[model samples]
Target chain A: MADFSTDAARALAGPVWLSDRRAYAAAEFASMPPPDATDEEWRYSAIQEFDLSEFALLSDVRGAEATPSGMGDNVLGDAGAVIRTANGRISSIEVDDELAAAGVYVGPLAASGQGSAQLGAVSADATDYFTVLNDAFAVEPLLIHVPAGVVLRKPIVVTHHLSGNRGAAFPRLVVHVGADAQAEVLDYHTSAQGSLLACPVTELDVASAGRLSYLNVQQLGTETWQFSSHLARAERDASLTASTAAFGGGYARTRSDVRLVGRGANCDLLALYFGDGNQGLDFRTYQDHVAPDTTSNLLYKGVVSDAARSIYTGLIRVRPEARGTNAFQTNRNLKLGDKAWVESVPNLEIENNDVRCSHASAVGPVDTEQQFYLESRGVRSSEAERLIVAGFLEEVLESLPVAAVRETLRHQIDAKLSQHVEHVEHVELDELVENTELGGG
Target chain B: MSTLVIEGLRARVGGQDILKGVDLSMASGEVHAVMGPNGSGKSTLAYVLAGHPNFEVLGGSVRLDDLELLDLPAWERAQAGLFLAMQYPTEVPGVALRDLLRVSVSTSNDASEIEAAMRQEAKRIGFGEKFLERSLNVDLSGGEMKRNETLQLGVLRPRFAIIDEIDSGLDFDALRMVSARVEAATKEHNMGALVITHYSRVFEQLKPDTVHVFYGGRIQQTGGADLAQELEDTGYRRWSNENG
Candidate 1:
C-alpha cells in the first residue's frame, strides 16, 4: 500500500538513530498483515473497508508557518507552552520563559537529542499494527519533559492541523512527568478538507508520587479515518487522569491501555463521544493492575443519531500479585434515532481473591420517562430529547480533568444536538416507546 | 376569573378504562379537593388532564376558559397555563433545578433574573442554592422532592395546578410548609388548584373551597371542606360498590 518501503523511511531528514529505527519498523510493518474484523482486537471495527493505498505519506519535515487563524486557538486563557502543527509539520512552538528555566523542555523529540531516547519507552510493550505503522512514518514526534519536583502551574497545549487531499499524517506525542512533579497537557486533532488517514500514538510516563492530567480532543473532518493508540504507565503512589472527547471522523477508533506498574498507583480514565450522520466510533480499553493496593476507575459515555453506530469494549484485569486492588468500569450509550445502534460490553478478570472489581454497561434509546418529565415542565418534545441527551453526556464532560475545555465541549455538544434535533423529531416515537419498555429507567 | 371545564372525560390505560364520563368545573383563586381510596382514578384524572402519552382519550373536552387544552400536547397545555405536580417525580440526572425552572418560565429571556427569582423561591422553601444546582430530583429525599415540586410551582405561577398526592411522603412539618406554599401561590397568582389525596390531613392547612368524592372513575359526592373529614372518619367503603 502506497510503497511503505524501508528505503523510503531511511530517506527522511532526521537523526541517524530515528532513521534507523524507522527503517526497522517499516520492514516489520510490511511483513505484518492488515487487521480485519475477524480478529478479536478489531471486532466490530471498519478495518476491512480501510484502503491504505488511497493515501500517500506527505513529509517527514516539521512546518514553521503561522497556524491558520481559528485552527487551534487557545480555549484556555493561559498556557505554559503552545505547539502547532500543520499536515504532520510543526507550524510553531512557544514556551514560557519561566517554564523553560525550570528545566521543562517542549520541542521536537529529535531536537532534544538524548531526550528522544524515551520516545517509545512506555508504548513499546503495547505496540499493535497501527502503532508500528506510526513508528515507521511519524513525521516528527513532540516531547514534553518535566524534570523532578517541577510542577508546571499551567497546561501545555498542542494542536495538530491536518489539511491533506488523499494524504496521511502520523502524529506522535510523548509526555514524561518526573518524580513528585505535576503536569497537565491538552492535544487537539483537527483537519480542514480532504479524505485522509491519521495514525497517532501517545505515551505517558508518570514517575513515583507524580501527578499528570492529559486530554485528547479529536475534531477531524468527516472524510478522515483515525486509528489512535494511548499508552500510559504509573509508578508507585503516582496518579494519572486521561480523557478523550471524539466528535468528528468517518470511522474513528481509539485503543487505550493503562498499566499500574507499582504499588499504590491510582488512575482515572474518562471519555465522551457523540456520533451523528454516518459516523462510527469504536473504543477498546484495558486497565491492568500489576501491584497491590492500586485503583483504576473508567467511565465512557456516547450518543449516536441518524444511521451512526458505536461500540465500546472494556476489560479490568487484576494480576495474581495485585491484592487489594479496586477496579470499576462503566459504559453507557444513548441511541436517539431508530436506525442508530450501540454495542456496549464490559468485562472483569481478577486473579486475586482480595481484589474488588465491578463492570457495568447499558445501551438503549433516550428515556421516555425523562422526556415526559421535561415535557411536563413545558419543554417541547424535541427540545426535551436534546436536553436529556446533552445531560446524559454532561456527566463525563463536566468530569474532564481540564476545567477550561469543559464549557467548550458542552457547547460543542449542544451545537451538534441543535443540528440533529429536527431529524430526531422525524424518528418514529412508537419505535422509541417500544425501546423504552425494553430499556432500564 | 378564568374557568377550567371538563365534560364527559373518558380515558383508558393499557386497555383498562380509568376515567368514565367525569364532569367538573372550577374557577381561578378557588381550590378543590378530590378525595378517594387508592385505585379510584384520582391519579388517572390528573394524568389525563396533563395529556400523558400513555393514556388514550376515548372521548372528552377539557377547556381552560376558551382554549381547548385536550387538543394540544403536554408542553402546549403547560404554556396555556396548566401545571401538574406529579406524585412520583422522575429523576433527571445532570439537569439542575435552576436550569429546568429557567426553561419552564419561558417568558423571561434574562437568565440572571430567572436565577434570582428561583433563588428567592428556594430560600422561601428553605432550600440552598447548592441544592438548586444539583441534578433535579436525583438523590433527593421524599420531603425534598415534594419541596422541589413546590418550588417549581412557585416559580411557574401557572393559572391552574393539579397537585397529585403531594402529602404522601412528607412529615408533619413538611406537609404544613408545602401546603402553606401552595396557599401563598394561590393568593399571589389567582391560581386555581385541584388537590388529590387519600388522607384528609393536608386539608387542615390547605382549606379547600370544595371537596368531591371520587369513585369508579367518577365523582360520586360533592360538598364543602367537611367532606374530606367525613370520608377520613368513615373510610371509602360506601363508594366501593359503585363500580358494579
Candidate 2:
C-alpha cells in the first residue's frame, strides 16, 4: 500500500504553474494539523472515531449504477440525471438541452472549469485544515448556475458514487443563483459494500432577490464514513431553504454555515437523520445575520435505535448591524432503544436588542403512551414505534422538495426501524397513506 | 342482542376510592343515562369501561357485548365495539383532524371504500369540509371537539358507546348537536349506549330509554325515562340516604 501521505499527495498533483492555486491549497492542507477534541466547537465530538489509514480513494464506481440505495423513483439514476462518478470516470453529463439553454448549468468540478476562475472570489482563506483538505483533493465537483429571472420547475439531482475501502472521496458542489432567480438543487451520495470515507464541501450564493432551495441525501453503507460542510451566503432580499437526510453511515459529521449579508434576506434550514447500530451521526449548523431585517428558522429531528448515537449543535447569531432580525432554532430527538443516545444544543447570540430570537431542544425516548396507543390498535409494537418515530421526524420530512424523495425517505426509515428491532413486521401507516383526506392542494 | 354488564365495578384515582360497587347493564338498541349529582362516579364509569390507564380498576367486572372489556386495552376495546366520548379529550398537536379521523377509521375497519365514504359522511354530520383539515382538537372550540367526538362515533360505528358528560360546557346549539350525533349513530347502527351526565339537559335531548341513578358509587335505582325526569325534578336529594 502506498504511504497515506503520498496517496493523499498524488490526488492533488496538477501541472505546476505560476498561478499555482491548486498546489498552494495542497501545501497548506499537508502543513495543517488535525482538529483536536479540546476545541470548544468540537465538544462531545468523537474526533478519534475518524482515522486516515482505514480508507482509500474510491477508484471503482460500477456498483452504484446497479442500484442507488434508495426506495423508489425519487432517487438518482433518472434519465435527466448523470451517473459519471459512479462509472469511475468523469463521464459525459446529459442535461435537458432546454434547461441548459435556459441559463441553467449542472456539471462536475472540472466541467465547471469554465467558471472555475470566479470560485476563488468567494473561496475561504483556508483558516482551518479540513476545509483546505477538501479544496486540494476533490473529484470533478458539481456546479450549478441559474441566470437572473429564470425559474426551473424541476430540481437538479447530483449523485456521488463511492466504492469500498473507507478511502476518503472529496465531493464538492458550488451553486450560484443569480438575482431574482428560483432554482432547486439536490445532492445524493451513495457507497458500495465495505468501509469508505466520503468528504464533501458545498458552497452556495443566493444573489439579490433570488430564491434557492437546496437538499442533500446521504445514504452510505453502514461501514462507510463521511464528513461534510456546507457554507452559504444570501444577498439583499434573497431567500434560501435547505433540507438534509442521512439514512445510512458508520460515522458521519455534517456542518453547515449560513451568512445573511443583505437586508430583508431569509434562510430556512431543516435536517433529519436515522441512526442505528454502532452509528454515530453528528450535525453542526450556524445561522449568522450581518444585515438588518434578516431572518432564519431551523428545525432538526433524529430517530435513533440500537447502539446508535447522534449529536446536534445549532446556533442563531445576530450581529449588531442585524437589527430587526428574527431567528428561531429547535431540535427534537426520539430514542427507540435504551442503547440509543442523543445530545442536542440549540443556542442563540443576539447583539442587537431589536431582534427576536429563540432556541429550544429536547432529547427523549419514544413516548410510552403514544406507542401503546398504536399497539392497542393492532399496529404491532415495532410498527407502532416506527409511526411514533416518524411523527417525530415529520417536520423535517415536510421540508423535502420532491415527492419521490419523501417517499424513499419514509421507506428507508421504516426499513431501518425494522432492522434495528427484531420481530418488526413492517406495517404501512395510514397517516403516510395518500388520500383526499390528505387533501391535495 | 348485544348486552353490556357491569358488576361490582370499583375504581380509584390518586389513591381515593371513586366507585364503591357500581353495577348497571344495557341491551342493544337501548340508551341508558347514568345520572348523579356532581362528584358522583358518573364519569369514572365511562373511563373505567374504556380502560383508561390512570383510573385503576380496583374490583370490577365490565363485559361489553358479552366480551370482557376490562381485560383489553383502550383502543382495542374500541375496536371490539365500545366507544367513549371522553369528557376531556386528549390534545394531539400536529396531527391533522382529517388524518386522525381517517387513520382511526381505517385502522379499525380496514374498509376499502373508506376514503370516499368518509368525505361524504363528514359533511352529513354537520362538520364542514374544513373540520378534517384542522388539527385534532387543537385550537378547537368546545362545540367543535364534541362534534368531532360524535363524528368518530359515526365513522367508527361501534356497537356500544359511553358518552361522558357530552353536555358540559356546551351552549344550547352545541348540546343539541352532540345529542343529535349520538341519536343518529345509535338509530342507524343498532348501537347500545350509556350516556353519563351530571345535568339532566343532555338526557332531555337524548331521551334515553333507560335511566340508572348513581349515588355513593353504586347504582341505586333503574327505571325508564321517568327516573331521569324524577332526578331532574328532585335533584337526587330524595336519594340522600346514600349521599356521602
lDDT per residue as tens, model 1, B107-198? 55688887877888888878667878888889999899988888888888889999999998899998998988898888998999999999
Q: Highest TM-score among the candidates is held by which one?
A: 1
For residues B1-244, what per-residue lDDT tens digits would candidate 2 score against the true structure? 6888999899998899999998887888789898888877787777778776778888879887568988987767877877888776655444554555445554555545565566666666567768776655668777777877777777667788888889876889878877977877778878888898877788656879988888888888999988887887778886776564
- Please give the lDDT score at residue A98 for candidate 1: 96
- The lDDT, on a scale of 0 to 1, for candidate 2 is 0.74
Which number leads on lDDT? Answer: 1
User: How far is A241's C-alpha from truth in model 1 (Å)?
Assistant: 0.9
Candidate 1 docking band: medium
Candidate 1, residue A137: the lDDT equals 90
Error of 2 at B206 (Å): 1.8
DockQ of 1: 0.69
Per model, how many backbone clashes are there? 2, 9
